[model samples]
Target chain A: MDLSGLFAQVLNGLQYGLLLFLISSGLTLIFGVMGVINLAHGSMFMIGAYLAYVIASLTGALWLALPLAVLGGLAMGAALEAGLFRRFYKREHLDQVLLTFALILLFEEARSAMLGNDFHAVPVPAILDFSVPVTAEFAYSAYRLAVLVVCLFVALLMFLGIERTRIGSAVRAAAEKPEMVDLLGLDARRIHLLVFAVGTALAMLAGALAAPLQSVYPNMGESFLIICFVVVVVGGVGSIAGAFWAALLIGLVDTLGKAYLPEIAGLVVYLLMAGVLLWRPSGLFAPGR
Target chain B: MTPPILEARGLQAGYGEGLVLRGVDIAVRPGEAIGLMGRNGMGKTTLIRTLLGQLPARAGQVLADGRDITREATFRRAQRGIAVVPEGRGVFASLSVMENLLLAARPDADGRTPWPLERVLTTFPRLAQRARNRGDQLSGGEQQMLAIGRALMTNPRLLILDEATEGLAPLLRDEIWRTIRTIREAGLACIVVDKTVGAVLSVVDRAEILVKGSLVWSGRPDALRADPELMHRHLGV
Candidate 1:
């Protein structure tokens, strides 16, 4: 591979990893704090993509769809948590899995009923559609670079939101000991609701951003969901930092493997997960809380 | 003479089939200090859990400031000016000392933030030194202090301490006792549970003995100290 090719591949890997981070971070958080196994999370991503498509088609602007998707995701997440997830907090993992899996069906059915099964492409915003010149001989895709910038910015915000802020500490503390959170006059249910809502919004946001890259379809989220699971497992069940590093590693491995060795590209991400699990069972950053 | 800050009446609860708290009744008045003392495997922890609404009351009612809160959630009870430093300290192992305190900082029903960040940090100099260290990294004494500080941060009218000085050096234990005295002197209602009978007696105004999931005896601490036979029979002190 040439220098520009390598650079482009690296950029693509980072972009892919960051997107994975956005989705899996929510998965890990919900699992870590609420001990929920949200299989339907991918459905939320799909819904976001569809939301992007509909809004973009109507407004002819991708930017306008972003905020609406986020707000909708938050409302949907909070509703799901209040109406469904909190009830399953103490239930068995199998029940949670079944519940969320059922939600995926319900969500997909609603999507099919509302919009019909079809693939739709979102237009890249006109402002960001033009590529910046990196060198005399080559220029990268402007939309992809914009994705990198947006994902990185979101990741930074997540880090600050969960690490530096008081609410972040509450979330972390609740993950360790929810009863303590209750005893501290902070409702654990509210914390769980907050986490769920944020997770949903981030998933939707990731989907809306990627709508331009990978045309929206009926079950695009299934693939992303599986990859997110791999990221969560490789990172650790409930560690945000773990999800981040794991996402980047998997992204690079999967992307580069596809580019260099397409024959076994599908097996590489799973192989990495297995290797990591064999080394550290719980995950890379599960602080024994 | 004022109404009790917390009152539990006929609270019966247990794990599965084994009943641990059997019709346990206790009350803490404003500015009162209580010592709930019992040997291991008794209902000392159970009663605290039930009172805090962590466990459901199978039989009767739990009232906070004269309002029924038996069906309320634990955090709701906490929001009503009740706080507990539960057994094992109940500190968030993932959070730092400062974070632990900050997470619990809430105004009481009167909307008075009595125990602000600065006040709590000043109350526990050891916690102040280790503000940025995670809960698991702290020693037992520090954990206890952090728990107390965290509870105080809620500006609770009533605070409950379970196993206040279980595993600590003599100096640390004395410090804890001193802090309890200060809390009592500040006119906050408190429930202190400890194995150290002398230390608990020194800080608490009233001593209640738990025997087989019930309040076996309740009297002034000075009276209990004078009666070693009663102490041996109930608290095994």
Candidate 2:
């Protein structure tokens, strides 16, 4: 492949990686802290895209739709936590998987009942609809580039929030020992609720961001959810930084592998996960856990 | 007419299908030190758990600072100035020692400065030296110190230490004991649970002995010390 082809692929990989990171970071936090393996996370992503489609069409303002989509996602997450997930916090992982899997089916059916089975699209804000030239014959969408920048900013913000803020410490501490966090005078239940809400919002944000780049459909989140599980496993269960790095690694591998090694592209990310697991057992960067 | 900072009467709790603490009673006034002694499986730790609301109290009451906290969640009890250095330390293994300490550092329940970070570091100098290390990386003794430091950082009105020096070396055990004494001198209510009855008895104002999940005896340390047979009858291995 030529340099421009490589450059375009790299951009594709990064943009895809950021999206995966946005979604998977939430998955990691929920699983790591609350010990819930939510099978419906991808459903939240699908819901985000669908919400953006609905809201943008109604308001004719992409900016307004995005925040509303996030708020919508947060409400959905809180509802899921209070209504269903809360009952399963102390249950076994097997039970959680089954419950969350049921949720995925429930959400998909709900979406179909509300919006029907037809595909939908989100409007690309007119300003970002332009493109920047990569090579003599190649150009990349400015919208995708903007996603890369926005996701990076969000990632940085999330990292600092968890690492530097008092609430962040409570989050980290709660994941380790929920009762112990209570012993420290912070309500573990409140932290769990907050984390579930945030995780859900992040998934929705990714969905909203990705809607302009792809067709929004009922099952669009299925593949991304699988990809997110891969990212979480390869990044370590509870580490956000791990998710960030692993998401990029998987994104680049999947994007470039499909381009250059089309014959075996489908197997590259799984292979990388296996290799990392064989080496570390845990993912590459979970510090003490 | 001030109530005890922590008072439990006929508190009953246990693991699923296996009762551990059967109607245990204990009390601690402000700035008082108490020793809890019992053999393995006798439910000393279970009593602590029930008192802190970590376990559901099957019967009886837990009053803290004159408030009945029997139905309160564990964290709410903690916010009311209940802190514990639980068995196994329960340190945040993924965080640095400093982070572990800071995670629980806040003003006491009354919003007064008590054991600040600087004070905790000064109290446990080894923790200061290893502040940058992760919880899992600390020596068992250091982890114990960090645990106590973490609890103290909360500036709790009542601090409970369960087997604070269980696996430490001789020197470290002494160091832990010394720190416990220092904390007592600093005027904090503390409950020290240890198998070494003599060490615990020496420091505490009052002592209680448990047998088969029931309190068999309780009194000032001098009364227990005066009767050597009491130790052999209740605490002897």
Candidate 3:
């Protein structure tokens, strides 16, 4: 690959990883704090794309669609936690799997009924349509750069929110010992609700942001779902920072692998996961001493 | 007699068909210290769990400050100024000493900040030195102190300490017992469950004994000491 091509691929890897982090950060938290395996996380992303597509088409603007998608995700997450995930927190993993899997079908059917199973595309906001002149002959796509900036901004906000605030500490505390949180009289339900809602909104936001990059279609959530689980496991079951770095590493490996070693691309990310597990079974940033 | 700030009447609870607390009843008046004593599997912890609303009372009621709180959630009970430094220390292992203390810090019901972070850190100067260390990094004695300090941060009117000094060295255990005495002296109502019979007797105003999930005895600590046969029969200490 040429110098510019390598740089573009590296950027592509970072962008892809950031997007994965947006989604996997939620996945790890929902699993870590709430102890609920949210198999439908990718569906949040898929729904975001569909929401983006619908909104962009209706209002002819992606910006308005973004906030609406976020709002929709938050409400959706809150509703799901209250109605479904709340009850399943203590249930066996088999039951949780059944519940979330049912949700995937429900979402897919609803998507088909509401938007039809047709492939759709969201137009990039006209403002970000141009490229930055990195080199005279080679430049970076402004849209991809914008996605990277937005993802990083969100990541920074999440870092500050989870690390610097009282609620953030409580969430971290809950992730370690939920019953203890309740014993402290901190209302574990509210914490769970907050974590779930935020997780859902994040996944959806990732999807909404990615809609222009990757066209939307039926079961689009399924494609990202397994990879997200990988990210969650490799990052550590409940560590957000772990998920962040792990997602980036996976993204670079997957993107660069496909770019450079096409035939073995599919095998590399899993190999990385295997390697990480072999080295640190709990995860890269496991919670304890 | 003063009305109990916390009370459990006929608390019948257990795990999945095996009853642990069979018709157990206990109460703690304002600023009263209680030693809930028993051997292993005698439902001492179960009774505490039921009072805190972590375990449901199958056929009884829990009242807080004379109000029925049987149906209240655990956090709601905490909002009412009930806090437990549960068994196993229950510290947030991944969180720093400061974070764990600050996470649950709040003004009491009447908008009082009696147990702020500064006061708590002062109380446990050992904790002050290790404010940035994670909970798991603390020694057993330090973890127990952190748990108590964290509970104090809530400005709880009533604090429960299950296994307050379960697995500490003799010196650390002495340190915890001193702290517990200090907490009781600071005018906080407390429920302490510990295997150290002599230590428990020294601190609590009243001693309540459980045997096979029933409150078989309750009286002054001296009264408990007078009945060695009773202690040998129930406590096995």
Candidate 4:
């Protein structure tokens, strides 16, 4: 590839990595602290994209739909936690997987029933429709850049929230030693609910941002979900920083591979993940030790 | 002079089909220390589980501060001033020492009894040096101290320590006993489970010995200490 092409591919990788980080961070948080393997997490992303599509169409402003989509995601996540995930907190991991997988089916069907199976588009705001010239003949879309900036901001906020605040301390405690968190007279169940909501909200935000870049459809989140798991696994389960770095790595590898390794692109990410596991079975950034 | 701070009446509990605690009854008065003694698999741990509501009491009552707490969740029971330093320390291996202590600290109504970071450090000086260390990073002795310190942070009316010093070195075990004495002297009701008959006899006011999931003997610690054969038969120590 030429210089400008390589630089463009690199930016694409960064943008994609940031989005993956947004989604995987929440998944890692829920899994690390609550130990709940929520297979339905991707469904929440799909719900966000659909919500953004509906809101943007109704309001005729993409920016106006962002917060609404996030709120919807939070509500859906909290409801799922209180009604379904809470019951499975102490159950086996296999059961949690099965239940959440069932939720994916339910979510897809519900979306179809409510929003129909037609593909939807989230138009970029008119002001951000143009591309910024990086070189004499090369450019990147302003909307995609905006998504990158917003994702980075949220990622920073999440890091601060988990590492600095009193609530974050409680979350870290609960994630590490749930029983001890209970012994402290804190309502761990409430903490779990909050974490689930926050995680879902982040996923929603990612979906909403990606709506303009990708078509909104019932199955849009499924492919992203698989890649997000790869992000989680390669980064190390439950490590936000790990997710951040791994997302970038995966983004670059996947983007560059797809750009260059047309025939073998599909095998590239899996090969990278297998190599990571071979070196560090747990992950590149396993949290506990 | 006052009603027992905690009591269990006719408590029966088990794991699966095998009964572990059969009609076990125990009580702890304010400012008193009681020791639970039994050989391996004699239901001492089971009794602790039933009392904490971690294991369901099939047919009995658990009361905290004269209030019926049989139906209360474990966290609710904790909110009502009951704290447990569980067996094996139960430290969150991934959490920092300060984080573990902070999680267990409860703010009093006036917020004066808060177990501040400094107070915890002072209580367990070892924790001070390793405040940023994860639970799994600490030695067995340090983890036990952290467990006790974590429970103390809750400002609980009743503290229960299950196997408080099971795997510690002799010197560390002595330090734990000294700390228990200090806590009891501070007027907190405590129930301790330990295999060291001598140390337990020295610290607790009363002792209960369990055999085959039944409390076969209950009396003043002196009464049991006077009969070494009793200790050997039931406690094997």
Native contact fraction, candidates in order: 0.96, 0.80, 0.91, 0.74
| Ranking, DockQ, top scorer first | 3, 2, 1, 4
Judging by TM-score against the true structure, name the best candidate: 3
Query: Where does model 2 exceed 4 Å of error?
Result: A135-138, A274-279
DockQ leader: 3
Expressed as tens digits, the lDDT of each residue in B86-175 for candidate 3 is 999888888889999988888999999998888898899999999999888989889999999999999999998898888899999998
**What are the lDDT figures for the candidates, one per model?**
0.88, 0.88, 0.90, 0.86
TM-score on B-chain, cand. 1: 0.96
List model 1 lDDT by residue over A1-289, tens digit each.
5888877888899999999999999999998899888999999889888988998899888888789888998999999999989899999999999999999999999999999998887888888888778888778889999888988898999889988999899888887787788888887877899999999999999999899988899888999999999999988877788888989988898999998889999999998788878988787666663
Report iRMS values in order.
Answer: 1.4, 1.3, 1.1, 1.8
The 10-residue segment with the lowest total lDDT in model 2 chain A? A60-69
- Looking at model 4 chain A, report the run of 10 residues with the lowest lDDT sum: A175-184
- Which residue ranges in model 4 land beyond 4 Å of their true spot? A91-95, A135-138, A275-281, B108-116
Compared with the true structure, what per-residue lDDT tens digits does model 4 show for residues B107-222?
A: 64455674566776787899999999988899999999999998988888788999899899999999999988888887888888888888988988899888878888999988
Q: What's the TM-score of chain B for every model shown?
A: 0.96, 0.96, 0.97, 0.94
Rank ordering of all candidates by TM-score, starting from the highest: 3, 1, 2, 4
DockQ for every model comes to: 0.72, 0.72, 0.78, 0.60
Clash count, predicted structure 4? 1
Which residue pairs in candidate 3 have backbone atoms (N, alpha carbon, C) closer than 3 angstroms, thus clashing? Answer: none
- Any residue pairs clashing in model 2, and if so which? none
Model 2, native contacts kept? 0.80
> What's the lDDT for residue A59 in model 1?
83
Better of 2 and 4 by lDDT: 2
